[model samples]
Target: MLRVFQECPELKLSSHGRKMAKFGRATPEIEGLVVASGLSPLIMCSLDTGDRRLMSTFVEYWHKETSRFHLPVGEVTITLDDVTSLLHLPIIGVLHSFELLHVDDVVDMLVELLEVSIAEARVEKIQCHGSYVRLSWLHDVYQMKI
Candidate 1:
């Protein structure tokens, strides 16, 4: 995932605060909270823009097995083993810490992520607001149109 972000020429590390984004680094306590709240860990990636502002986007949690898998199915605990297994889960909303980024750059970065880090995920749909972008990824699909 880091390698994919590194390939983007437009992506640079933020200089002021926490310089880089961390992936799958949720501590045990944090994971426990997320599991209890039925909240999946949404993978967030950030980059520094030309103007020295931070640009970030939310990508589906391709590796959120810990929290998402242990959900209760009626009386039984069911594990979602497939990457696209969470299609039935409702996306409550988009969580944005700062202003959303442009659609094109977000799209490009997601494509790179799919191509590099997660080779099995598929982009099912892309919803673009004026500032924010939301994407849905399905089960394994070899070729991506984008």
Candidate 2:
């Protein structure tokens, strides 16, 4: 089943202590509580560029994943094998039990998925807000006659 769901307030990383506009979606907030225990909703970011700020949120560890290896399923004990398979990439980073290289593989993955060079998309105006690097055109199928 291809379930397409988004958290109404997907992520509440407080950048520069600004309030997040509620996304106005139907779904409830994604309460990643256990790991994100003490983290404030506003991130208060001092990063200069928008892309960096946006990417930083993903790179940093969220509260929910801390202090335990909790997964959606009932049983707890999760292995790097599990995360690696889900992400479809070999696990790399502090695996706690094994050694591997390329700790920031996820950053590369995000950049590729967005199809933009993080180096180039880093701009001043987009500071904090970040860049919407993709563009699409939708031509009128036919003009409606009034």
Candidate 3:
């Protein structure tokens, strides 16, 4: 399962002289909160335009039924430890799950979590096209709270 596939050919990637778009980073005001949540490592990460050819090769070799990479040498799949090590995220913690079956439930969740008025929650739900609000709006709310 851990053997390397030497039969695979080397990948060639081309960027076509195109530059990747830059994304906004977290504000300094949110630094403390991000650190407290154990996500500060993500802030230090850099972005790059990825290799499409390599990604295509991986996709070509992927076996959805087995949920593993069917390489020449062996089957490969990512584990929770791989995610923990690569992303520096906590693996052992209470898992939170919730389900909202209706718009009223979504409105109630928004009101309870954001501490906004029921009318405001309903407006946000409508503006966001049901059951979801924009992250920017949530950021604004957080800013207002702090």
Best by TM-score: 3
| Residue lDDT tens for model 2, 11-69 | 44434322222212111222343123322222222333556555544433233546343
What is residue 59's positional error in candidate 3, in angstroms?
2.1
Q: Candidates' TM-scores?
A: 0.21, 0.20, 0.51
* Residue 81's lDDT in candidate 3: 97
Per-residue CA lDDT of candidate 1, range 39-83, in tens? Answer: 453333233356432232211222245443221232223354432
- Give the per-residue lDDT digits (tens) of candidate 3, residues 101-130: 588998886676667789988888889887
lDDT for 83 in candidate 2 is 49
**Highest-scoring model, lDDT:** 3
lDDT of each: 0.37, 0.34, 0.68
Give the range of the ten consecutive residues with the poorest summed lDDT in model 1.
54-63
Please identify model 3 stretches exceeding 4 Å from their true place.
1-47, 93-95, 101-120, 135-146
Residue 103 local lDDT, model 2: 23
lDDT (0-100) at residue 81 of candidate 2?
A: 93
Q: Output the TM-score of candidate 3.
A: 0.51
Clashes in predicted model 3: 0
